[model samples]
Target: YSHHLKQGGAYKCSASNIRWEVTRETHIEYKTTLWEDHLTHQQRNSWIIAGLLWEITANSEDITAIHLPHFIDYQALNDLDPPLIQIANFKDGSVSLEPASKVHPTRVVFENPKFSLLGVIICLLPCIRPIPVKGLVMVYHSQEAADVTLHVYIIPDDPAMQEAIKLKEKGSRHIMKPPVVRSMYFGHDYLLKSPCKQVEIKPKQGVEFCYVRSGQTINFYEVYSKNVNENITLWLHAMNSETCLWEAEVRPGDLSSHGDQTEADSQYDLINREHRRNLIKHINVMQPICSNLLDYNIITDEEKEAILSHPTASEKKR
Candidate 1:
């Protein structure tokens, strides 16, 4: 997967370097690759066959909140007079990342929703058998949802569907939510809120894509240094969850010509030497970049200026 990422062509950002623009192309490539590599055909089949039930369980109590979009007729649903929604025909299904994480993948389900709408009209018009469906759903989490818009019409005789039905027959609990589009648009906030910044550009200029999250960033840098190579490093933080004290080091591909270290490093050293030593020990074993945010109470505008001044700033032209 990392290999393909290096092979994938780079998207030169002709636009201004907004947070979204800086990491847009890279996020898309990383997500598409993860869908292809991390998940298997059988796992996807299990989700389509069995996971849908997990999405629609009625008695589940974990729903924190619900918001019905204006498009949905709230009164109609409340009155049990809702408009007929097409039952999704599970012709095919695949796993797609709604959000990038090991657990996030389990919460997503994608199915074609066209057959239910068309099956009703088939008697009026002589439509071909097994019409290819559109609006492939990408992800929908059950626990976070109060009501679902889609219902599955499990095609009889399908081994996978049959298994799902048997489980249903046994009174297995399941859950459902409104179908979401397969993979959010690349510009969406899901990708833009990455904990790791787009710190550097690959100068050799082949292609690059990256997946950054709380703990690590799987960065793919395709350089013209002979053949394409994968320079992946794990990002580590001193604190769990969101904190100003987290640190990361410069990766091999992200090194700047200005210098090997940044101005923030001196500041980071002053915050806590004991913690820094322990962090460095873990970092040496992990090979992660120790970042410059260790000492700051909050990342103020002035501090942001100092941080951005590092070659790590993506807005700076390489």
Candidate 2:
């Protein structure tokens, strides 16, 4: 899997220039007669698009169209056998495959009176050569007595898989500073090596870097620290190649304790939740607030999309 999913978006707004963002939802077992004959092959391609869903919301009902970005590359799409692509718009618990009016290397343009959850579903042959994918490396750590343990995961950059890793790491500190994306093959041999002296990595001699989404047989590397309080770096690269694909530095000292939050912070969060409705009802202006939220890094782009989804000022405030 050596493919990457890049997406961009547009919504109906009066501002000549505005910020936009894209987020993904889980994949659904979509059924349609469009590709009835190739059902099995399509199923094999489902994991590639499981988190490919893109959600877009706008304020204007009379807006002309929405351009949704999908996972499949236009170049790779050209290589697709017949290159069949359809927009799966999900709403009210039912999903319909809508033919996009326009398709480009980067975007699939479409128009809808109202649309909710949407993702691109591409039909391709199962026997085709492997495509590159955007893969993620997650590093988790725990220290007990004089020993430190590190668990590293290299898996698909899917929403569902990442969420499962979150649950899997509960009470364990995620020691990675930031996420590092790498291009990988589904079953190819990728290497994870560390230069730390005397560190013991399990199954090291003839291990293959194997991974299934998250729920299945998850293949990870468990490393025992050579010395207590020692920092380490894990290197990921293709086997037989020295080129570094991705690297993560685990520094235990940089992270705060689990209970580091002060009482004032907790009280502020409580008040914010209690008066959320009051603020939503009373706010007369929303555009500035939305922009401020973006500027202050207080809300994610997904949250901004949700806030703008509401048509009215009070509704958007909510």
Candidate 3:
């Protein structure tokens, strides 16, 4: 789940800083071979110094064919479990081991002509299931008394399985939102913010409003307007859409014949005015709530205090 490099004075890039320049102090050679029995006759015969260098240098675009004929032990190689050898020009270099399933031919390459200790192991194919393997790199110095250093690196195959292991450490199903009916009324606009996770609204007879949550639903009947003669219930459904105002309907009550044309026009104007006020209020209330809830906490302290100070039905009754 986590990765860390081992720390020690041995692994340190510089110990006392005598400025150990690898190029000036050391003459180096590197080579790798599979166990003699594992290599075919063709592989043994065709394996010229040029061919070995070509394979090692192919992945490194900066390395050219001019640098060749590096010394390698031909007769000493034998068939072993980890089947390869590598030769390098520096005392310090990196080694990479890629699984056979994830790589073709299972090879290593130096990417740069000015070779430091960096090696890249190309994994040609994705690893499947899991496999175990070992790798080793030996760093030799020119001075006989200088200690030979070895750096080892390994990569396990199952990344997907590693992710599954990480998931086990953290418990499942934490609640993101708490249950509540968050509503605010501003001017003629009524804004409702809920942590119900889902919401549904339906228009019934009369100018009644229904608010539903997880375990209960509250209905508001004639809550806003008292004049029921020309009642027009505007139901806004928020279930199918994000903006409730976009999905709204108006149900009109029957008009009396005795009503004057001027009176009817006035009533219609009043309704229109109420609707427009409601729209503005909706924007104001939802703007703050949505901005604070969905975006960063943008609601100001002054606005929050104003909401808290405002009297409710229970306060009025008291």
Clashes of 1: 18
Q: Which ten residues in a row have the lowest lDDT in candidate 1?
A: 115-124
lDDT of 1 at 294: 21
Using TM-score as the yardstick, the better of models 2 and 3 is 2
TM-score for candidate 2, please give it. 0.60
lDDT of each: 0.22, 0.55, 0.25
What ranges in model 1 sit over 4 Å off?
1-201, 218-318
lDDT of 2 by residue, 21-115 (tens): 22322111111122222224545455244234544444324334555544343345455443356676666656666776766655566664254
Residue 270 C-alpha lDDT in model 1:
76
Model 1's alpha-carbon lDDT is 0.22
Residue-level lDDT tens digits of model 3 in 206-226: 222211112332222221222
Best by lDDT: 2
